[model samples]
Target chain A: MSSASPFHGLSAFPATPANIDGRVDTEALGRLLERLCEAGVASIGLLGSTGIYAYLTREERLRAVKAAVECVAGRIPLIVGAGALRTDHAVGLARDAEAAGADALLLAPVSYTPLTQEEAYEHFLAVAKATKLPVCIYNNPGTTHFTFSRELLQRLSDIETIRAVKMPLPVDGDLPGELAALREKTDLAIGYSGDWGAADALLSGADAWYSVVGGLLPRTTLGLAKAAMAGDVDGARRLDKLFAPLWQTFKAFGSIRVVYMLLEHLSLARAELPRPLLPLKSADRQRVLEIVEPLIALEGGRKS
Target chain B: MSSASPFHGLSAFPATPANIDGRVDTEALGRLLERLCEAGVASIGLLGSTGIYAYLTREERLRAVKAAVECVAGRIPLIVGAGALRTDHAVGLARDAEAAGADALLLAPVSYTPLTQEEAYEHFLAVAKATKLPVCIYNNPGTTHFTFSRELLQRLSDIETIRAVKMPLPVDGDLPGELAALREKTDLAIGYSGDWGAADALLSGADAWYSVVGGLLPRTTLGLAKAAMAGDVDGARRLDKLFAPLWQTFKAFGSIRVVYMLLEHLSLARAELPRPLLPLKSADRQRVLEIVEPLIALEGGRKS
Candidate 1:
């Protein structure tokens, strides 16, 4: 795990601010990317699950990638998510991201029909082979619903361009043990999402924190990431405690909803979550405000 | 439920045959629907799960609806699946189905974010309000991953256009009890999918069998459906026994995979299952063939 590797540190996943009609607000998105770059996170995970990649159109996704590529300007690695329900569509998305100048690809087996492991393998193979960019296997079953077996992960690790995996937090909360098992099996750089688990994951020697909050509060999230990565247990726990309230809100109402509300409250963007995904109710939003306001103040009082 | 309701009796869902690019082969699709019409199924579920509704684009889906409406020519009610991950997208799809001449809409709370029951309610309400066509709530947790609470179903049933529900077979397998409980709560016609359980579901007094096998072997499935719905316990069991081997294949391999293989073997269409959904392996296909060939013969052999 090197600093230069996009998979090695705090990889900030920003929501692709889009309208109710699913049109990407490229300017708003560019502002979010700029914040990530300034904060000097390891990478920008654009169009990830938190970014609503599943909800946006390919044309809109391409536009977001192009804007991100321009806005980041080689300051940060832009890992674009290229997940789609159809493998061919994912392949096309990967190619689009590559052609539009993404530094790497993140592909989840975004499935409607539940996929067999072999099908997931073939899907990843097809997409990785379609682009020269390195690919990270997105093993988030919460949204995709396709769980990868260890054997399947080992098989996927053999793909030349597949260099990393973004895994969900293990159910039993055994990061160190899970990391040891995964490390023994495959040489792919391993990272974890589930923002609340970041301190433990990094402290346990995981390579990266794929952070949703990092997208909005990059500097504060980076502070926590650095402390954990440097083996500063006390410092990391202190920062982690600061995030506890926000984490509770994330658990209570999905992290995506919390992040979106924070983005709006910080006045970074006024984007709507694509519908069926509603904004937090007024009461919920007020609760989130109360929880995050102090954290935002500690986060240098919001850039905007 | 009246016989005139598309929710009543056997609703035969058919695969929407398409090229590798997801360009719906409307002519091929028409051929599949024509068979369902000639079989005199109670309704033609043109874009149900087996139809690959989630895989197709809105334009392709609308083309499929137009083709089915023309081909079926009102002989059987045409039920179009108007489900999308986004609520606005679903509303658009519902409007498309209505404008393209679909008789009824099947709305699944197709989710990428796991939806709250209230979110699911709002999604259904928006789509139902968007179209004049009667709507059937598609409660398929297998693909959608959003389970509807009984209360949410009751709430959706109160919406004027929301006329029915297509439920997954209960986990406890107590169809009689589940159906009786649901009947107590709402006037909405209740149906069940899961082809292997269709006999028991219909026999247990479910208003409809949203059958996947009914998509391919309409006559054979109709035989089982008719016997079961008519309260012929012995006759239904006898027909169901004939289907036991086929049902075993469906359970072993997903019904979609088996249905596509059966379609090709019957020479109805040379359509491919969209990528990420690979064709069954040769040995598996051979096994499927061995299981279904006899059933096809019982279906009076292939039409084309």
Candidate 2:
């Protein structure tokens, strides 16, 4: 059952494109999904952190999910992020995802209150009860401030619809050891985010790379994941080194801001980020360009 | 003008009690407000962190605010928490709060995407634009995971509607220095939360105590604040010492859970906590009881 999650391999979390007035730009989203599918990425995630789900109203988020499902058109599995601070709202979002034809639901335990493990487990259970779609627990302490303990994760695995887990980079930076420990405890399929640590997690046999970089550089990111998955350690390392500059920009700043900057740099998306979240500063954007421009030239051109 | 903000005093953030089915216990909420007003607390902050605003749906939060306004009956100033992930929704919440007759609004920069200072400013500005009520910036990095910098706070002070700020405990733990510096830069009236640090902050010329304990222990907590505000340093210290044990329990278990437990122990409200956040564990509750029992006795008896 651990190996049975449909969300294995490199999954691209495409940034949600919004118009000047902040409406979801479904036409642009469709184009982005087409590029990802054409690049042979394993799955596509809509409304993840990269998609700015938190900054969109419920109606807008539901609209984006519908558009993503329509655009992906079943070329590959479409995983939709369905997290909210309230359990009832999360359940509502899950049902919406299912109704919109999403293949699976990824949830983060987002809270304004510091959640106890018991509460987080209850949140997942309630949402799972509401939707038949397979659920993937997205553990991102940096953003959500709730780290799902291994024992709790193992407990949650008993829920029939809880099929996978997306882990943050281990706090001690011990990706290999932590992944090994998680694998030992539960049959839950485990993936990892944090673009800086994707190479390490993929090389360490993690099931998926829930990626920000994959959204922009699908072919390149897919190559790296495929190399690591196939045990081509040298190829994976080479790709890691090649992408090091971009990773440095991400680490120095934040992945969300950097990814949005990169998308804007490539002219793939508008520079608009949701309000109360400014775009990367001009100096940081220039620095990122210095890192990415050479790679863009070397790779011939961006897909756009 | 900043010093003239109406939020200067002991403001109790009463927890929003819910029924077995998770509906807001309006009768309990009204009784709690009546108790606080009777005890002569300076203000009432409804739908705050203690109110578990994040766990509530938009409609539920609006309902709670409306009920609180009706209960308070304009007996004292009421500041309602109006925060959301999206600026539009936050503005909507702000409008609802205003329509409900709230005197002011307290907002935390609650975001899934880590916001730049500029983004946070834009968020506040948008909400301020939408409502006539004075806005108090809520800086609880522990929960909201976004801190309002002194520089940004000073900048936001230029917005006429942005009148006050609810600061978290300073990271460096320099209460006097940080508060003085914030005062020097921003004319915004600065208040502080974190019940453990209330004594230091109130004694250091901060204008308000946005208190949790006050909600359940109004007379005793207000006595401490009044003492500090009146420059009775010794009296403030004595109260802080007396409350130290309960504060420690709050730090270890989380204020939300501990406050709910204390409220339950006193029979001030039902023991129900919003889902995904359980009440204090029994052992921790016992430890809290060990610390609080003496104080409860000295207070003569709880309102129950």
Best by TM-score: 1
Worst 10 residues of 2 chain B by lDDT: B1-10
lDDT of 1 by residue, A1-304 (tens): 1226778899999988988898999999989898888889999999999999999999999999999989985688889999999988898999999888888989999888889999999999999999898899999899999999999999999998999999999999999999999999999999999998999999999999999999999999999999999999999999999999999999999989988878888989989888888889999999999988888898788665
Model 1 residue B106 lDDT?
Answer: 94
TM-score of chain B of each: 0.97, 0.95
Error of 1 at A157 (Å): 0.9
- Which docking band does candidate 1 fall into? high
Q: Which stretches of candidate 1 lie over 4 Å from their true place?
A: A1-3, B1-3
Clashing pairs in 2: A119-B276, A276-B119
lDDT of 1 by residue, B1-304 (tens): 1236799999999998988888988887878877887888999888888999999999999899888878875578888999999888898899998887888999999999889988898889888889788999999898999998889888888899899999998999999899988998888999999888988998889999999988898898999999999999999999888888888988887889988878788989988899989888999999888877778898898766
Point out where model 2 deviates above 4 Å: A1-5, A20-22, A261-271, A286-290, A294-304, B1-5, B19-22, B262-271, B283-300
Q: Best candidate per DockQ, number? A: 1
- Candidate 2's residue-wise lDDT over B1-304, tens digit each? 1122357989888888875346787777888888888888888888888887776778878788887788775578888889877787789899998887888899988877777788899989999999888989988888788877778988999999898899888879998998779888988888989998888888888999999988888888999999999989999999989999988888888888887777777887784777667777678888998899877876558655
